[model samples]
Target: MEDDNISDTDRALGFTIPARHARGRIVRLGPVLDTILAAHAYPPAIEALLAEALTLAALIGSTLKDAGGQLTLQAQTDGGVVKLLVCDYKGGELRGYVDFDAERLAAGPEQPSLFALFGAGYLAITFDQAATRERYQGIVPLDGDTLAQAAQNYFVQSEQIPTLVKLGIARRADGSHVAGGLFLQHLPEGEEGRERLHTRLDHPEWEHVAILGGTMGIDELADPVLSLETLIWRLFNEEDEVRLLSEVAMTRGCRCSPEYIAQVLGKFPVEEQRAMAGDDGMITVDCAFCAQKFPVAVTNVVL
Candidate 1:
């Protein structure tokens, strides 16, 4: 059944299948994704990849332990489609961008797979918690065919947690974008008991749920009319029980502001700052995340 309580777009629903001893999260990104991608006119392939990255970031961010913290997912590659794709999630806000070779992308193969687009690359995930001074990061080789598969590999290889991830992205006739993802993880039983158990391999329940998840098609996942609750029920209703834990709202937001840009420019030498000024005697700074432009006056800046 669909949950009438939550809004239609940019939301995540966390659930647990106690009978299977597994936890999962489903996310729908509509207007938020459209707004983020609309900020820049990227090629169709680049836009799709960015949407996938944003969806993955939200899925991982919703599972963070820290309330006041940020999760950053970055993909660095030496390929024709994209060089760098970064997405950051903080609170309920998400933003991302991509750097690619335009000429190469235009001349490359049509609809290249993730591995082909990011040939021999790495995916890095960083966690920055406000309560702690230390930042944690994990790196994994991008060996999967899709970003979602790579994420699954990360949890299994780096975190040693059995996980399955699926992501879907689509473009509407109006040129807007929509993205959604499903994440399932087997929670650790206990540290003491885990060591005693020896190996934390995949369970039969994990395989069962993963097979059910694979039945979902990209159209169903990315459909704006499909409510997350309905989708979850459709996927796991046959199970003994599926419980909805909580819901989180997501938005399209950037951490860029005039003061922040001014502070960054202030670090440069006076001559360098002057050289950055335009003919109008104002230094213009463009934010890569939101594509917002900030024009700063020389006299107004304190350097």
Candidate 2:
């Protein structure tokens, strides 16, 4: 059943329907990246690197709810040559950082592959549960040519889930960046649900869904063609009925805060804190994601 508030067309992208409410999510990941990562002038290769991470993070985070569970996506390569972490909790808040050879920036986007930036790295996906349940973690080698393909490989090899992904990025006329993407997955249906995908698996149903999603171009993301309503309707018009649930609004948000920094500083022994503070008796914390620095006085520490 489609909620009266949601039109079938609108469910195409950028909102979360509760679990079982909807089977998949389509996302627009750019513009937000430019806002968060492009403020500082990074060379083109690094810029693209961050852009891909941001896009991947958005898609991964879309799977769960912000109220309790948060998804962390990590790409760590050899000897700190390339290490990036991007986390998007259920709340839509996101933060991430990229580390690579500054000289490599001159090497150009084509020269450095995502893996080259961080050689011999692995991709890790972790689900953090708030309810005292165990956190779940999965790892896959970074093997694919593009981030999307790498993630797709991660699904097949690590999780054994059949998934398809399409990612497109573009720069806006005003210089902001925008990225658009789609994800389609076929899972074992319930006795009845499984009966459906299975019955249709041999048929053209899965292919039909993938083909429509792949057609969406950069323009659809930069500026949506139809509201989320019409888009979903048009895509699933073939189904007996597609159910659209409550809308979840998403935006660019960072979870970093002063108290969070204090906790990190507290992790060190009091003596180590004192030594790091030096004669000034202060410590500095810079957000890896946005590079914003927070300076705190030693006196502020209860220790």
Candidate 3:
């Protein structure tokens, strides 16, 4: 899709088709994806769900124009095996975690549908601007069997951009996990930045490209041997040209640290901090996203 250089792991590629008035993103997550999921010791079904959510986060998060901004995806259920799920991406740094009832999950089916797993839940996507501290969020129903379908609902309802999302995940013999996803949208028409989406959903160009995109199978996405460049070329080579943009590198990252934890703990009252300390006079704060613990001494920290 670009030059000879092509990334097969832990990268997101952005591209546009001028003639079709469309643009898309492709993400391949390897070691980083493995690291994020393995630390949780989740069941296979839970891990699969999180992998898709994390990959979806990366696909759309990388499109943020502001380098300092962040994208967060959260799913919540009132009565289901999984009570909560959250994932976020900033500057290509990815982290996610899920909270669930072990007993309930153990009794669940070998594979559960979205409604079966969540019962009644909603998925929220939030964009946080680091510079202006502005936050925009959109919430949609968890309708389809896959998270990819939920994302599509978001684009069609909130963004009003005709979109397609496909995700795949596979586990190797070594027990490591890999995930990949594609996000394609019809570029709106108008002046440079002021373009508006085609209110009528039946554009000829979008229909044609979306059909080609729909032909992609989920298995092809999770194939370790398949390069993202090869996949893009296979799908859109019939077009005049595909302009591939720079690739964004993704990695396992956590914002949790001793100093950061202490700063947050400082906001609590001194008596409350004392009650949280262990016999050793230290409070250990655990981060679910990274599976890391930070020890904060009440005496050392201003609480």
Candidate 4:
């Protein structure tokens, strides 16, 4: 019961269960994820962690109020394998990178839990909207077994909303990486609305949907052969109504450009810029997000 019409690449489907009063989002990342991860040669564990970060960013960023806004998810840790992992999302475009202690990663555990890999860290979500002068940020401790759990914790702690997230990452037979995720949130009803609906803050529908969502396997989540619609139906078709709201296309995009790089370099003193120049008398900078290198002439760097 798969949909033959839609491509199995980067896409997100937003849906809702009106009877259950729940909202959910499902995303599949194919070439978009492969391209982003292939830019850097990271260890398997580090790569998996980065994939989860990117998937979480996409699920949460799609909820941004402004179309021109960007959402960034960052994890800063004092662990052996990872120092920082950042993912940026804007208008369905996503990019991410990981910073790890090479020596530590080489000697670390073969397979560590998310908490072990990112020990004693904080997860921060920041919203940057072009229309607003001030950016908004929320920080929560990383105390979960997985990145999705951390995100769910954020919503429960910061927004006071009950949320659940399931994330999966795997390598295809061809050695490329792909990721998928499911996000569900219970819509809070106002006091009057709750009375009319006979729904309490701890509604039974939320637990019911979450229990059904827990049945999803990682393979089903990450498999390109499986259609998102099929997955949705399999999960919640038994409900009164499963409505598809919209679908968004995603791509591997980076915000870094030569002009932007030059502007950042301009902030430094000329002497400092000169000190950063290579033997060829040019300053080379590599974008942390995309790993794209931009070489600028030392003389062209305005002080």
Candidate 5:
């Protein structure tokens, strides 16, 4: 299979081929990206970047189907609350956040470059399996300026697999957000298949494919006039036998629970917990991802 026509909408609409007889690929994303980023109050640049990262993260989680697996993409800066985390669970639930210095948003976008915003950081992928399997983690330095390039680098270095990620973010006129992305990877198989696919991907025509794939903007995606199905056909309508696997949808969900928070509170020293709990006899825990606040009474917390 030629690795030339890889695009987000193409796969979002459904692109399928056998991994053995052909290279299997799927790339789909849209409103779900907006849903994840819309829950937060983020600056324009930061919002755009994180949305792109979240799109890729969700796609990865969906594609890598492991009932007990979860993937988290975190980018932490040196001295800012600008930390970004997007977590994906095995069941296709996705949640994301942009932690920032309160004053930073007021100071404006000029304060931090993407690198400085997330200084000296790294990208990590954690995998968990069934039967209480040991978790595996792979971490790599953030060598690229953009998250797309950084993630692509991670696959190249860690898995010895060549891949390409294209992400685009746009601001809507009514203050909404939209994002879309594509991931093209050279699958590990026979040397002949790998070499042929790599050559096509590196071709100049492939650049045109990449360029055109990113032009679908926020307005087009969010507009009711254009749906994911129409968008995909717009790209690869000419292909006769393009098979779309099951359509996967992504939404924001926080894994935090009252029971989970209670366990966390138990980690602190008894004296500290007592001091914070106060005479009001209650503790409030807000989820970092969804901002869902949970208030628990002192009597409810048990060691």
Candidate 6:
């Protein structure tokens, strides 16, 4: 189900601290995270990286001006255990996958550094507007200790908006995974336009907000019991006022189906399609994000 308002655990929300010239988003993923991660049976390190990517997607994607727009976070590397990582979000739906060298990962330390996992990689955040068909993307090197730190650098270095992010991942006693994140940005006091030319390098209000966000612990963030609203109030309770936004529910949204698979297979050359068919004369396609297989009969594919 999408946007189910009954539960608060698997949802993301945006809020603003007008008094401090700042805005932020927080997300806590429960069963949705478990479902997507369990489908692939990835290694623990890969799972943690993917979880952070998903959390960043949701935290940033929720800010899309057009509800129909899509936000994609991609990381590519060379000469590393992890080769590529991708995650996308649209209308409160998220799906992500990671490609890594299993043998190399097994030989590495139990908890590898970002450099160990991705020797030389870059992180890209792209937004595809729904109505305008316009695409905006920011690319930055994987330079920080954690993905969250890299994201903060993304906004500061690429977008030039001072930002901070705290991402957390945890496993329950039952061995189920969960993730959460916080994204805060300083909107300097200036003109009411997309480009606020008057952004200060050392804004006092932004520092106050960032310091508060930095105080949050990973355990506190990944805790399933804390509501999103509570997390916000906990940080800004002493402030003059804080406005809460409506929550957007999330799920393991994988855009894959048999009909769609058949349509794609119909595009391939008939000879190539037939050559790829299995013993049953069917071309089987597996969706990487969902780990679901779709078999289309060669006879039905006419390209």
- All candidates' lDDT scores? 0.84, 0.61, 0.87, 0.83, 0.59, 0.86
What TM-score does each of the candidates earn? 0.89, 0.80, 0.93, 0.89, 0.72, 0.92
Tens digits of per-residue lDDT, candidate 5, 1-303, equal 323343233124234322322222333454665666666767766677677777667656665545556777766566544665555545566777777766765675554566666767777876676556767677777767677788878766776555556665565577655565555544334322354324333434334444444555544443333455565556555544445656665555677898888888887777677777856888888786776788876666657
Deviation (Å) of 202 in candidate 3: 2.2
lDDT, residue 53, candidate 3: 94
Any runs in candidate 3 off by more than 4 Å, and if so which? 1-7, 190-198
Q: TM-score for candidate 2, please give it.
A: 0.80
- Tens digit of lDDT per residue, candidate 1, span 1-303? 444464466999988887776788889899999889889888888888999999999999987767788999999995536788889998879999998888877787778888767888989999999888569898998987899989988877777777889899988898777888999887545211143244355677678878898888888788878888888989998998898977889998698888888888888888888899998889998888998899998766756
Candidate 6 or 4, higher TM-score? 6
Misplaced by over 4 Å in model 6 are 1-8, 189-198, 269-272, 275-280
> Stretches of candidate 1 above 4 Å error?
1-7, 190-199, 266-281
lDDT tens per residue, model 6, 87-162: 9999999999998999999999999999899888898999999999999999999988999988988988877788
Candidate 5, lDDT over the whole model: 0.59
Model 1: pairs clashing at backbone N, Cα or C within 3 Å: none
Best by TM-score: 3
lDDT of candidate 3 over 6-45, digit per residue (tens): 4378999998888887889999899999888878888888
Off by over 4 Å in 4: 3-7, 190-201, 267-281
User: What are the clashing pairs of model 4?
Assistant: none
What lDDT score is found at residue 189 in candidate 4?
A: 66
Best by lDDT: 3
User: Clashing residue pairs, candidate 6?
Assistant: none
lDDT of 4: 0.83
